[model samples]
Target: MRAPLKLYLAGPDVFLPNAAAQAEAKCRLCAEFGMTGIAPFNPDLDMARPAAQLWQEIYADDLRMMRESDAILANLTPFRGASADAGTLVELGWFLGQGKPVFGYSNSAVSFAARSRAQPDDALPGTAIEDFGLADNLMIEGSLTLPLTLPPDGQCRPFDSLEIFQLCLEGIAGWGQGFNR
Candidate 1:
């Protein structure tokens, strides 16, 4: 039998207050679908290290996880701004560079253009909003032919909402099955 697919879970959820709990929930969902979710947190890291070293260690560990993962399931939900988390976007690019299957979901149902327009005038002056009806920048959305997994009701949800997360998981699970065939 084929081994379970290892999926790198990329998102800003790690910044949430209940980050560990969120990761555990996500991992459980992944197992239910025959995949392993590798959340960004590494419990083995030495927390006593200096700030600089901690950052470096986290970066190195994340890169290693990405390399070891079979694919990436990214949360494209906008966070702290009008776009998805910058770190998650970079991770997505890295996965794409590695030629791994890329899947994404957005907690927000709003189109990228709408979200851009909602940004403060000074935030995106003279920026042309691309109207592809995608949840994020065209470069990110254009990489995949498949539409991003969204909430069934077509409404926005909290970033930590398991409902939407499960939708994304289901989408990735389906994609993985077809890919393996």
Candidate 2:
């Protein structure tokens, strides 16, 4: 029998108040879909180390996990400012660079240009706003192996919402089936 696909779950969900719980929930959903979800925070680092050392260890460990995964499922919901989590984007790029399949979902219904523009016609100061009607940056959306389609109603939940997360998992599972063939 084939082993279940390992998916590196990348997102800003690690910053959520109940990150561990969220990870568990996502893992459970992955299991339901015949895949294993590896949340970025699943590793238990030694807290006794110095703060800087611990952070470095955590980053290294997460990268190791990403390298081992079969593919990546990233939550591209706008974070901090008007873009996806910078760290998550980096991970996604790393996985893409490795030639692995990439999938993403964004909770925001707004387009990237709409979110970045200060006003309807105003650009992001000096930078040009891409009017591609995509969720985030074109490089991100263009790299996705599966399209992120919103529900018919067009309403989306928060980053921690299991509903949206499940959608991402389903996409990964479907992609995996085709990928293995």
The prediction achieving the highest TM-score against the true structure is 1
Weakest ten-residue segment in model 1 by summed lDDT: 172-181
Q: Which stretches of candidate 1 lie over 4 Å from their true place?
A: none
Candidate 2's TM-score reads 0.90
| Candidate 2: tens digits of C-alpha lDDT, residues 16-76 | 9998999998889999999989999944788789998998998999988997899898988
Report RMSD for candidate 2.
2.5
What local lDDT does model 2 show for residue 69?
93
Q: State in Å the error of residue 6, model 2.
A: 0.5
lDDT value, residue 169 of candidate 1: 77
Q: Across residues 16-134, which tens digit of lDDT does each residue of candidate 1 receive?
A: 89989999999999999999999998778998999989999999999999988988888889998879999999999998888888888888988888988888888547978788877
Candidate 2 stretches with Cα past 4 Å from truth are 119-126, 149-152
Q: What is the lDDT of residue 179 in candidate 2?
A: 68
